[model samples]
Target: MALAGVRVVELAGLAPVPFCGMILADFGAKVIRVDRTKVTMAMDTQARGKRSLALNLKTPEGVSVLRKLCVQSDVVLEPYRKGVMEKLGLGPEELLKENPRLIYARLTGYGQSGSYAAAAGHDINYLAMSGLLSMLGRRGEKPYAPLNLVADFAGGGLTCALGVVMALLERSQSGRGQVIDTSMVEGAAYVGSFMWKSRSIGMWNNPRGENMLDSGAPFYDTYQTSDRKYMAVGAIEPQFYSQLLHGLGLDDADLPSQMSFSDWPKLRQVFTDCFATKTQAEWRAVFDGTDACVTPVLSLEEVSSHPHNQQRESFLQDSQGEESPRPAPVLSRTPAQPCQGRDPFIGEHTRAVLEEYGYQPQDIDRMLSTGVLECNAAKARL
Candidate 1:
């Protein structure tokens, strides 16, 4: 309940914007998702703990309603390309003029003022352009995408949320709000700072996958077991490496020096052969409670039932009976509550929200009848 009094108006879009709103809502912020009247409401996991208001922004009445919401809200999160909001007369300049303490956060692939600002791109494209993609795959293989986690959610949503919180903190002193331009490409590069800085330290001079943490070291890679499942190894320090060798039933005197680059492939093969002697479960039992830094690579279906995950209650079933991850980075004082209901249908709370914003029942009826607003019951099914 850290953000108990915070109000966030989230313009519904794809992953990034919804993700930002989800984090806010998780921490007790009231998040209202503004969706287009014509769009169908997909069951987006990010829509948990949020209400929906469906309006046609193309209509002047709809724009007026949004402006009124901004006048009383603390933050507005948008993921449109540059100039889209300006065309609708809801740009930062106009909105901030109405409410000086409003935080206008813009999340996009590029930035608000870049050559690629208006170009359409997804997570893969942003990662490719950020130079982070070049350092991803094996030395000679094509770089494997990390599946939208890096750019779309981590870079875009998480970064924007952090910026919004920081701006809010600063506003406490300045008593003014400013526009936040968050570019996923720039955010992606920022998150890969260690990779970029490592080059000057000579630790990252080699090609991708030829470095210590990139699966170059024999002690820091995955090996296949007899049953074809894999175990991840991260015996980085000398003590952990020693534990790993002990668990593998190998004598130190018989093996090559641990840090010898020339011996990596041979040692990796040794590990591969040794792991192939048992199934993943067998090896898991072997190193069950030791600090050997080895663990089975679990499949998605196997995760919820895993002992550690079950002990920690890392995943929980939502009100709709779907398994979803719990809110993370646990807080001692203000722990987040589990979300309690299904995601709102499009315009499910449109009437209620309009009433809260001071619109009379007659006004709501006129707007609904004029094609300026919509509700789930009025929309045609696909």
Candidate 2:
């Protein structure tokens, strides 16, 4: 495991922080998720590979406990509007004084200091600020957010994790850790760097959705099949486009040049009518394993059983028999491990986690008796 012996204190929030914690846990870090005292069932897939400790941070005792945890932790993930942690006395300035090796990773929408830093926003808002939203979706339609994937997960969570890893590498030589102020807005723009840089060149010449990769090109978009399902096409090269035409039983000689932007609508309609003549499965038979770059638009429930995914174990059944995606970026050796068991109920590991952190039995019992801690069992139907 790459992150073996790393201990992460994840102050639980929504999407981004949990996802960051999950990635560290996947790589063998021991992640303890600090949840609110009152919590419901675990519906989050990102909750995997974590132990939960429900503590009311609004209380002095809970904040003290968290401070102690940070003093002993390798990484502390904070996902809040700016100033919340500082108000709680758990900010990096205080914690890093105690634990010089602490990687205080802050994941936020705006950042530590900015015009919108104190304002509230969600994934869509962050993406919009990043300027990534303006180029998304179809040509004439309003900019459609891609369900929070770009900002929340890819930009915020994934970028924060990468920063934490790089900080760890730097700390090995410096013998000191640093704070990572990861703003989702900046991260989203960085993640979309390719598109941004390409736009200035010839790649993205037209307006939104009128470009080659943005569903503007008839050969690179999705088409509905006879079964009402869809297939995605990305036959950009001359060779692959030839394969796409051949798969559709069309001759290249009769069609417009592959790059004719003016004729794209005509080409799209022709491909649409042709795709509608066959089931998605039939088209899969024609294009699968070929260089056409055509693949069925599989549903959530359908992906686990797909031949390629199954062979690679891209999706695996967890301890509760629920199918979840496996950890990605496979390593030749010491590959990341999937979450082992059913996710913990809120506060399920409160007592156990406290004991692991060197709290005595009496201390644990006192915290449990007070309003400081909560220990629970059984899953809620949240």
Candidate 3:
């Protein structure tokens, strides 16, 4: 719980915003998500670990409510187009003027000042722009979309959260706040640092899946088993690759050597033909405790029920059987744990939060009546 006692107000719509809130909430921040009055609970995992405060930003009173919350918050995370927050009258300038130490983080598809800042885009577009999408998948095939994990979570959500924490730490000394404009595309590029270095040295090629880590090496790729299950291999070093060869009972003299690009196709065929002899489980048993770095590619369902995950309590349960994905890196002390609640229904905590903020009962009633805040009395919808 690195952010204990801190209060974070998340102005969220989708994806990264909710993820940033989740990270903040996991570490004990009082995360209050100001969500659209119309969005539903079932569609958003990012809304987990926070009290909901629904506001109709179409109304000026809604903007004022968020402004007040901004004044009281230590951090504010907004993932919108460049001008959307400014139009809402709760932009960084106004917010920082109210509280100089507040960490204001803005996440977007491109970035704050880029030419395409206001353009519509998604994870795939950002990944494409970073030259990362060009390096995924099998040789001579189209680049595969890596679900939305890269740009949305790794590049956008996680990066924005990291920036907020960094700014928060810096603010402790300066007592002055700043704005962080995080572009998902730029973040994606930052993540592909090795690719950039390779490009500089002319080791990079734009063709899909021809690079070493991108299925170019037979020893560092996925192979299908007899049961149609798959396993990953990572015998990158010569010694490890030798162990892999030995474990598979393949003769070094019979197989093509590593680094012989001209013979890689022939080597891959031999390896693939050999792997087809066994199921993924059989392959796992053979390499179980070896340094060859092989692993069965478990499905999501399998991972949820995995023994190692269960032993470590990696997944956490809510009232629903579904659990939070994975607990983060372990800390020596003050380990993070799961919050009991799921994503709250829209405005589920409006009245309660208003009360906690010292709004008098009469003021709360007036605000509710005046359309300043809204709440759902029913329990959160799954």
Top candidate, metric lDDT: 2
Compute each candidate's TM-score over C-alphas: 0.96, 0.97, 0.95
lDDT of 1: 0.90
Per-residue lDDT tens digits for candidate 1, residues 238-344, read 99899999999999899998989889889989998999999999999988899999999999788888999999999888777788788877889998875768778
What is the clash count of model 1? 0
lDDT of each: 0.90, 0.91, 0.82
lDDT of 2 by residue, 269-294 (tens): 99999999999999999999899999
Q: Pick the candidate with the highest TM-score.
A: 2
Can you give the lDDT of residue 153 in candidate 1? 90
Model 2, residue 33: distance off in Å is 0.5
Q: Which runs in model 2 stand beyond 4 Å of their true positions?
A: 42-44, 377-382
In candidate 3, which residue ranges exceed 4 Å CA deviation? Answer: 39-42, 200-206, 379-382
What's the count of clashing pairs in each model shown?
A: 0, 0, 1
Worst 10 residues of 2 by lDDT: 373-382
- Estimate, for each residue in 60-130, the C-alpha lDDT of model 3 and write its tens digit: 87777778888888888887888988887888998888898888989898998868989999999999987
Clashing pairs in 2: none
Q: List the residue pairs that clash in candidate 3.
A: 18-46
